[model samples]
Target: MKTAADIIIELIEKFDVHDAGSRRAHGKGEHHKARVELNEAGKDIFGEVENAVVRLSNAATNDKVPDWLVNIKGCSVRFNHPLRPIDIIGINFPYFPFDSAAETLDVLYRIHFYLEDKSAGRFMDIFRAGGLYRDLGKILKWMPKSTDMDHLYYTAHSYGGEHYKMKLDYHPGNDRIEIYAEKDEHLIDYHPGPAVHLGSILINPHSTGKEVKYFDVLNAPPGMPPNGNLPLLRHYVYKRSFLRRMEEKLLDGKDLRMLEEVWAEEKYFVLSKSQRIYDEIRELVKKGTDMSATRFRELLDEAYALKYEEKHLRNYLQHVWGHFKDEADESEKAHYTRLSEHPDPEAVNTFIHDLAIKYKEPYILRTTMVKTRGRS
Candidate 1:
């Protein structure tokens, strides 16, 4: 039985032989067009049911993989029983390719040519920091094209538990490519079964899940779902939910500013606070203690009893106001005017406390009560 390392070594050897032959036939430096030739023997060894091809192309002169000849592979697979032109196999690279075939081979061979290794992990880290999908979009255009295939499938391992899969359909006569993906829940799995197609667990005989859903990539805004910054998406959702709660409460300007301050404070705590703080707060609220206006003031005072850092508070308020300024309506404008008047501190304190209870966001009560020496 050939291990993954063995398989990779075999494939590299085959690619070397083919590359040398191509260089000889086309004359050195003359073969500008990239080519992908399938190796049936290597495919069988790699446990691929269909043929796999070695794709040779010039790597982009960028920070990702500067000035190198890249050799990657894609499998040829037929889908649907009476297979139509939808058959395609997408291959995802584990890391950015090195500059030359020798450099690439050396890096892979050093890692025993395994897909998941420290080197591969480093490559993935760099790839993600460099914008995973954006870099992929550039490489996809350089790959060999086939008229027989209707879609190109690309897959990658994510830092999260799930994997990433993208299906790209190129226009018949142009450079435009339409991207699609299986439903988010089905795209990746932590405990993936032997055959998990999209989100359905195929190994279980009693499974009755419907076919996976796919959505057009273009429908989502740039830097949003399907292929965008997940953290940014999460933050956006949190902000929207927070804003909605504020609207429901009809919070005044001062009230909004206080909540925004606490939110900023909580953001800083994400790096230092223990899960215990979050858990304890959730449990405290769940116990259903009366969190009336007085109780709210008590919590606020307890969280920020010292001299409050007015500068930090003002900065956060301005930052949030800037975000909503363009979208502010007449009512919002009036609220801002009221807030600018600086309502009584006791009233503002009560409002902040009430908001904490109402929204179940205790972190908002935890503000920097004291201004440190030498700081504004």
Candidate 2:
């Protein structure tokens, strides 16, 4: 297989959204203009999806340094199914927390880059704040004949798993209700909360028995089946096995069991002191230099933490690989292909470039770099 970078670069060459040299538009970037104009009402939805991806990737790395990001085959197909389109988004950002509130706003800086990308105008409008409504309204009122309104989907994500839920006390007469948590009691104990809520699709990867019952309660109308049975919506859960992309699969009975294990041990340890690590990065960012002698100590501690995460991940993957090789299935084999090799910097760059093409928009890639004892 080509290195991740090679695949990413190839995708960028084919899609050509932006150039690394000048960050300038070099091709007819608005290839999917119709899709963007039509799906104006679902902008926030899309944002949510992207956010979730970022958060998941970070969690996979334990929110540490030596950061890296994930790359994939392509977006158009991964997201839209058979009719594949080249939609890829790369997220890379400093993992360290900002020193002050003002620095937090920097999170939006990458969005601006997407807004200015000529081709991305086809499906996304990063300018407006009231999400889909405000931006699409502006587009329609100003250029009524200039765009369509049908080809878009909404997405979302959560950082601490707490952000994806309802924040308001009262409903404002909106049709969108909070998707309730679901789980299988035979498998897991508590819900990881709802991480995905799209249109009518309510997905909770960490649901349990009572949670599954809860899902039925929220989705069904106030009535029992003619036979007095409850209606259950079509739902899937991850089966916790060594299969690759198992995380992407619908949560299943096995997955619930694994989640039960995760819940039991998650609080056992605070793997690393992240704040100390972040303080060092903040000093570097603010001054572009750290004058204090102790700054070196801080940097060393951060680097050590990163190395630990890298080794830990490698060890876990090694175990997973052994299990996968032992009892492989077709779906398991396919996932193995995607995770077959570890990602490197060049591969990562290509992945990000491809993501830009897939989304037809610019995105932030929060990276976690790591140095493993393996040959390229």
Rate residue 220 of model 1 by lDDT. Answer: 19
lDDT score for candidate 2 against the true structure: 0.25
Q: How accurate is candidate 1 locally (lDDT)?
A: 0.31
Model 1 misplaced stretches (Cα beyond 4 Å): 1-69, 72-166, 171-173, 184-310, 319-376
lDDT of 2 by residue, 131-240 (tens): 33343443444231212111121111111122222111111132112222111111101123433333222222331222111011111111111111111111001111
Q: lDDT of each structure? A: 0.31, 0.25
- Candidate 2 residue 314 Cα shift, in angstroms, is 4.5
* Cα lDDT tens digits for candidate 1, 271-359: 12233333343343343323232333233323333343444333334433453456566766566556545543333334333433334
TM-score of each model, in listed order: 0.24, 0.19
Q: Which residue pairs collide in model 1, if any?
A: 68-99, 90-153, 186-199
